[model samples]
Target: MTQTTILPIDALFSRVEAIFLKAGLNAVQAGALARVIVAGERDACKSHGIYRIEGALRTVKAGKVKPDAVPVLDRNEGSAIVKVNAGGGFANPAFELGVPELAARARKLGIAALVINDCTHFSALWPEVEAVTNEGLAGLVMCPSYATVAPTGGNKPLLGTNPFAFGWPRKDTSPYVFDFATSVAARGEIELHRRAGKQLPEGWAIDADGNPTTDPEAALAGAMLPFGGHKGSAIGTMIELLAGIMIGDLTSPEVLDYLGTTTLAPFHGELIIAMSPEAFAKGRPGDPFARAEVLFEAIVGAGARLPSQRRFAARKKSEAEGVSLTAAEIEQLDRLLDKGLDAIA
Candidate 1:
């Protein structure tokens, strides 16, 4: 068996934060980033975990993202739409700055949307979705990435891997949450497969010649297929329309053009819609939360697993026994802290 080292979640977080600080990221940017990245690791989502640090550092080194940007919140009083301008920084801090107001507006208005603009996003959408659920509301989150996915019936890369996430609050237990890339897999997964010298599963992607391929490098050079063919393609287009075009931010194609490469984090916008279940169910016959629990129990009773169950299990284990990292991963973290951006390339 390969040897691994276990570190407390807080210890790992400090190391990650230190690396970002060394790379010149401001406190807000670094702290928020560390929280999400560490949470990814703690939940066993390796694709978005510490593996993402290098890409973020690369983005910083390229000057494509502002390391010291302070996100500004525009309350837009009496309106259901709240906005946070990231000033070209990482998206995590912007979402953090806007969430409380989003929750407040959602409670007051029954539904509210938070629009995050001018941000470099490289993390999973589940964290943001969970944040809203923690506020006792249901939430939907989505964002466009660099163009890397092909629309159905097309071989060229036109749409982003584009993630979508949803969360519903559950009392006395973890929230009901699901987060997934509209593509067959997230772009980060392909990168991780390449690093591990592993072949991707069939149907994930095609080569530059538009032929099916399992080679990670070839897939990276070509395009990833949408998850459910036309269905996923439609959802991806909707995300681009709602989160990109409607929010007045960069679309996947525009992002790819502006950056001219996919090596850096994609600069785009995010859309988060929060709805108070209590408010929505106020005049209805049943309690929404309790009703949801019944539905959840029935599904599980039929042996159908809920999404994120494995993630939550891993989170519980990590909290109890600490996070386990391969020796190479630990070494990489040490190198990052010591060399900062110089360690990335």
Candidate 2:
């Protein structure tokens, strides 16, 4: 059953922070992560939102993810390279710091590279890209997870459907944000479909023998196919190299057995690059912002919507009318929140 409940965004953040804190996260840590998570949900990214909170809590309880890990930055002077020692593994907070630091370094050297080791999963790269955009730079992000995808002609899950995000700033229009996982579909979407008892979409995944399957269960046990076949596979491979191999993470076949599971150092890798827009728009640039606006208006005006627009619009509606929840999810939350008389914590 569907149910309606109204929560101001601020209230939602507070509630999430309180819950995380009670779950053993330190106040600062809980608050920081809550901001990241709530923003994802608010932007209609349920896959990276509060839905992840339960998994994070489980990981913390299982001692795989630390609730309060501070990031340690490792940079090479004048080298445009850095490393982040993210304490406590994936789903921890340290990885967030590493992304921007790398972008900044990339800006200084026309190309920068950084690796996040043993850090927590940083939800939705868009939010992180927004950070780079604010710095007036063009940004590219490659974030990899445990292996959950197969190679072009093989099976048994040899790589992650690692997503790639690129952001280019405009003088007038909103930044051009391109964010998509390498797979035909993100695993989280499949996970959600499975949780909702729905079948997988066509061409989304392959069975253990490398044949396509619409059964979510089989897909889970199988491998996700690349988005554009070999092209996507090629891109996925590049992401794995930048995000995994460059960082000394599980590479190639090693990821096959462990992809999609939390036990592995899911923090694996993320590489970011930021370029000064001034480099490209140096001369005779008719207000890049104005140019972008005209292009965006022409496309969206002509029935072509930008990729993230749908979610952004849904979030706006949700914010105005409040988050809509199924009766079951609400009941589950209530039960979790009502555990014992000391639940207020």
The candidate that achieves the highest TM-score relative to the unseen native structure: 1
Q: Name the lDDT value of residue 138 in candidate 1.
A: 98
After superposition, the stretches of candidate 2 with alpha carbons farther than 4 Å from their true spots are 1-3, 89-92, 99-111, 171-173, 188-202, 252-265, 283-285, 317-345
Error of 2 at 34 (Å): 0.8
Give the alpha carbon lDDT tens digit for every residue of 1-345 in model 2.
Answer: 356566677877887787777777775568767887788778777777777667666656655567766667787676777777766554335545566676677566656666667655656778766667767777888867767789788876877778899887765435778888888987778888999999987988998778889988899888888889899999999987877787776564554344445333354556667777565565865866567678888998899887777666877777787766566656655654555213322
Off by over 4 Å in 1: 1-3, 188-202, 207-218
lDDT of each: 0.95, 0.71
The number of clashing residue pairs in model 2 is 8
TM-score of each: 0.94, 0.83
lDDT of 1 at 341: 85
Number of backbone-clashing residue pairs for each candidate, in the order shown = 0, 8
Q: Give the 10-residue window scoring lowest on summed lDDT in candidate 2.
A: 336-345
Give one digit per residue, the lDDT tens place, for model 1 in 179-257. 9889998787899899999999999998988889999999999999999889999999999999999999999999999
